[model samples]
Target: MTKNFNIWFKNFHAGIVLKVDVLIPTKDPSKIRPRLLQVLKGSDWVGEIIIETSKPLSRARVIGARKCSTEWIAMFDDDVEIPENWFDSILPFIQLKDILAISTPSIDVNNVHMIAYKRVMDHFRPLEQRDAPFIDNTLIKREVLLNYNPSPLFYSEDELLYRYIKKHGKWIHPPSCGVKHFLVMKDLVKAAIIMEQLGFYPLYKFLRSRVAYFTISILAIGYSHTYKTMTFFWKSNIKLMAGFLKARVNKKGII
Candidate 1:
């Protein structure tokens, strides 16, 4: 698979002059990190693969933008498994002048909680047309990305970049561009907590309403495969809401 990817990469990038770098910002070591590195190294289209484990995701991205020697950078999470032909799928758009950045939905159906979560997220920001781009599987131009400072929280950081990109230039979500994101219940809860802490309004604006949110939550619980998983999903949502409410009461400003 790796050899095929290299051959494909060389064939495609041979005509294109732009160099693409990859930056992975992770707070702690992850189980999937090794596989992720292996996959990235396999691609000849990718120039430098910089993994920064020291800073928060937002700061790490800034570091990557500064450190990268290429014109474009693909920012991704450590947990994401790049799909085969991922570069080939998006290379056409990269060749376009107006399309400054590109993003796609992360597909993962292994966990029931993940299914429910993705459903809600898809509802809000459909892959067909996104108001802002997601960072997990996105290709961004270094010039546009170097302008601002993103929030420390992962979700909010993505939100900040989305808005910034919208203000700067064109961003797109091509149907062909997609990646598999391995999500766990623990990480989901942690992300939700961070969203609330950083003033969840960034993502909240994309949501339909509180009513829709809870309705989908109930439907997700109903569709769970096992009682244990259902219980975990329920409790996690509760804790997430609690954190949001607490942040609201404390008068945290939403960026």
Candidate 2:
């Protein structure tokens, strides 16, 4: 468990009056958690350090945003490997006059499943010129997030929320402010189960399309020549398909 504390600091930007609060949404403490803490706590501009353990990313981010009393809220995932000067890199994008939220590119560090999964997902939901869909590493204004109050589903809630915010304001993706994402499969499996219980999948929006995902899975497996990569893709697809179908059979709406 996290011993929560609030720290105050003067706004760090030269011309901009931006006060930032970093929200870390984590369910369990892994090796990544301590590394993440080190990165986030090192920043002088980050004011509030809110650690929400054992909560969905969607719910955690929403709760964290509401608690934030700063100009910006950074809903960072706990498993990310953040670079030094992360704040400095993101500050300019967040400080943009019209940007409601800003997304940073997440580079896959070592997860083969993530690398393959990302390739498949890109076909279903491609990145927009002005916006990046994922909120795993994102910066948003307090009012914008609170006003939208995103209702996320089983998966790709970040994408849904990004589209929702895009309607009212701008979302930007800058390459300079990228973070390394480690996709742990156990966590993904748990999250998928939770999403099924919440009744958010089976709809034909975002990552709700079973056919699209399945098709990509087949393609991913067929394209890979190595045994290890093929096995990883196969197992991943089987698990996802099983969860998706189970949810669809249980519910009567939007399968």
Candidate 2, which ten residues in sequence have the lowest lDDT sum?
1-10
TM agreement with the true structure for every prediction: 0.75, 0.68
For all predictions, the C-alpha RMSD in Å is 5.8, 7.2
Local distance difference test, each candidate? 0.66, 0.64
Which lDDT tens digits does candidate 1 get at residues 77-160? 878887767776776666555666887777764577656755665656665475545567788878776776676645567766
Task: Give every collision pair in model 2.
Answer: 27-54
Tell me the tens digit of each residue's lDDT in model 2 across 1-255.
111111111233234334578877676655445777887777666788877663555666677778878867887877787787777677665445567887777867777645665666666664434245757787777787777655544355676677778888888877635588876555444345545655545455425444555555556654343456655655665676666656656664323
> Judged by lDDT against the true structure, how good is candidate 1?
0.66
Model 2's C-alpha root-mean-square deviation from the true structure amounts to 7.2
lDDT of 2 at 164: 76
